[model samples]
Target chain A: MRYGGDNRGRLLIIVLLVTSLFLITLDLRGVQVIDGLRTGTQTALTPVQKAGSWLVSPFRNFLSDVTHLGRTRNQMEKLTAENEKLRLTLQNRKTADAQLKQLKGVLNLAGTAGYEVVNAKVISQGSTTSFTQTITIDAGTSSGVRANMTVLSGYGLVGVVKYAYRDSALVQLASDPAFKIGARIAGTQQIGILSGQGTRKGVLQLLDNTTQVRKGDVLLARGSQNGRPFVPGVPIGEVTSVDNSPGAVTQTADVKFYTNFSTLGVVAVVVSGSSADPRDSLVPPKPRPTPLPTVTIYATPGAVEPTPTPTATK
Target chain B: MSLRRFFYSFPIFFTVFLLQEAVVTQMRLPAGGINLLLVVALIWAALSTPEIGALTGFGAGLMMDVSQTSPGPMGHWTLVLIIACYAIAFLGYGDDNIRGNPINIIFLVTIGVVAAQTVFLLLGMMLGQQVGSVSNIAFLLAGSAFWTAIISPLILKVISFFHANIFGMRSQL
Candidate 1:
């Protein structure tokens, strides 16, 4: 009996050791067994995920409502201030009229680029403690949102679409570690690669060591194709700091993103188009002329004569 | 009977896995964020049989490894989670008390965080990646661990509710 028990224990130990060793080897080889398991897991959990997301939709809506309320308040305050300024400026009628004409001419000269604005909504977010800062938007192939398309809010650039599905797409923010954008300093035109470093921070790598990039300088997309895909001069971020390492060939700077990602609300997906064109969807619509009311004179001869007689008596 | 139980638990395990992938990852706190799935796994292990707990940990960890951006070996998380589950189980809390015990939860979280960081450090060293400053790693680990510890109770409560209401287990809580 004792011998039999000892044999069983040894067998159990052997089995455990063998299984662990097998798992380790499988792991080292980068085997797809885990991937298969993950797919299987995802498939099985899709319904639950959908349900959970639906249940949480109200919370997201509430958060969005709060965000929009704050934004509306800010916009109201801004518009009020602008209204006062415009009222003051209205005192100089001739100068204002000339400025308006010049602006209108410039707008008329600009032509439309190819793309149009199609609206999209955010659907889901990344999962993990490591901060998968990507957002999945509802716009997909059918919506004309393609991979590498730029997504922007009124504030500034939100992110670039990394992967697009038939009904949804994932956007990797400029703050994600994997994102890289070619940018130039707005003032000095120093070209550099803006790479995300996993945190909410990004580093700008300049080509020339003596590049004249300063704090508060704006960064814009470089080599924009007629400003269609990415509208040229759309503010990306402001340079926060510059770093020059001794003996290093190039200089680098940290950028403070214009978009307040922590409180992201509504964003507009700018389709490809020429920035010089007056057909920008973001531009306010032209004011329509008020139509004059037409009156038909019914010449009732008797009524007209009586009215003239009454007026003469008065 | 063991296989049947595993098969039954598969759906719950899969849901936790997907939640970790889809929702929990987006919650960013300073240093690092809380890994709610890890906390759930620890709690589940404590409330169940040790063998099953270890297996679940291994399975979930393997899924995490695949889902993560890390290009390293797949079973790295699996090994770490399994070891953590086993260690937590051996700490010898009674099944009934383990569910609501704050001390137990904290202990398990500490072990899990330590195990995870240690494994990652070792893997990084083996893979010839820059380990960065030791102080930085320590700071990150400590901060993340505290964050995870603080949130573990809430996660535990939610998982326990699910286990009881959905999975039909009678919980001590």
Candidate 2:
């Protein structure tokens, strides 16, 4: 509209753009000042974020319940008597029940592996701009959380701490494309490298082609030497599919992470690694296949066929 | 764009920023999550003149770049937003029909968000960052656009009213 020789606007944009590029270069060059700014911003804002989280979670849940009403309707009918009973625990505080379950799961996981962990509430999820999938936990150096420490939920590895401030830490979700961990197939020493693809899914490359990498095979973190980033025997994911190329040096598979990063409310940071690799002990029990009622079917010819249902892993 | 607006925006930006981190981040849809701060800022830009829009972008980008959850280097967002917001402002500025129509403004915002995201990804690739597969990028773009489209009208109204009151555009209100 005002295309009439806006010299000032042009000058402002040029100066800002140049400044932006310079800051980017400085950050890329691993400048300490940039890190300080980032740390300072987060540290300064953590308390405010925590307060907001407490105040806003209810409205968020209400909104989610409204938007997801249709999906929830479908699930409501499929709920088991046990889940129905659990749902009745607190009619007004159903979310608390779910969070309690998740909290227990995280604690049980840490307890099993003899990990010295700091349990933290996930105050935030991924960024608004979303350069990477991440979460901010309500734990930090004061709680013994450090950058590169393994962070896991009840289900499995959620991420590793990217930066720890005084009372909060930023976790880079395992689903980030940049996330990588050494992993092993459950019940075997077959090692591989797992990398994220920006979803719950990941890609794993086994070092050897001779060892079988089959569908449904459980994967676990193989532990770093000092266990700074990943600890041994934490369940990583299950192989969803595999690609076997004849001349390839390694085998690759599509892995679905055990932890659903989106719905995560609670997680734990392992301040210290386990004394020994727990191996496959942490592997979650696979859901047993439903058995066919052969006798009943034979007696009742017109009866419906057995329909397999996926049990809710929540 | 004025010192008065700057004084008013600091608290507004930080509040929206906190809400984004606390609540918006938790409601991640299957496609992608909404960037509340981005949408709000873009709407603010879309309703303003080029000069004001540039200033809005500068503030929003700083909040984006310095955010702890931000994975990109310090300036990627700043650079992308300044250009995108300025262009949006330039196109919609002084156009009564466009500014008066909520539909036009929302459409402008949806496009601006997508454009900014594309530029950000391209910049990321240029810097050797992993941006995921083409399909992933496409999904993210559509998600951002869809969410922004759904959310921008409300933001446009709020930002428009705020500007009218604070920037003294009583006639517009």
lDDT of 1 by residue, A97-118 (tens): 5335533422332222233454
Which one wins on DockQ? Answer: 2
Deviation of model 1 at A159, angstroms: 2.5
DockQ of each: 0.21, 0.59
For candidate 1, give the lDDT of residue A108.
35
Tell me, by TM-score, which candidate is best: 2
Model 2, A108-193: lDDT tens per residue? Answer: 98889888899999887775355588888999999888999999899989999989999999998888988889999987779999
Error of 2 at A248 (Å): 4.1
List ranges where model 2 is wrong by over 4 Å: A63-93, A289-314, B1-8, B170-173
The interface RMSD values of the models, given in order, are 6.3, 2.0
Off by over 4 Å in 1: A1-54, A57-118, A223-234, A268-314, B17-33, B47-50, B62-80, B90-102, B114-147, B155-173
Once model 2 is optimally superposed onto the true structure by TM-score, how far is the C-alpha of residue A215 displaced, in angstroms? Answer: 0.8
Scoring only chain A, what TM-score does candidate 1 earn? 0.55
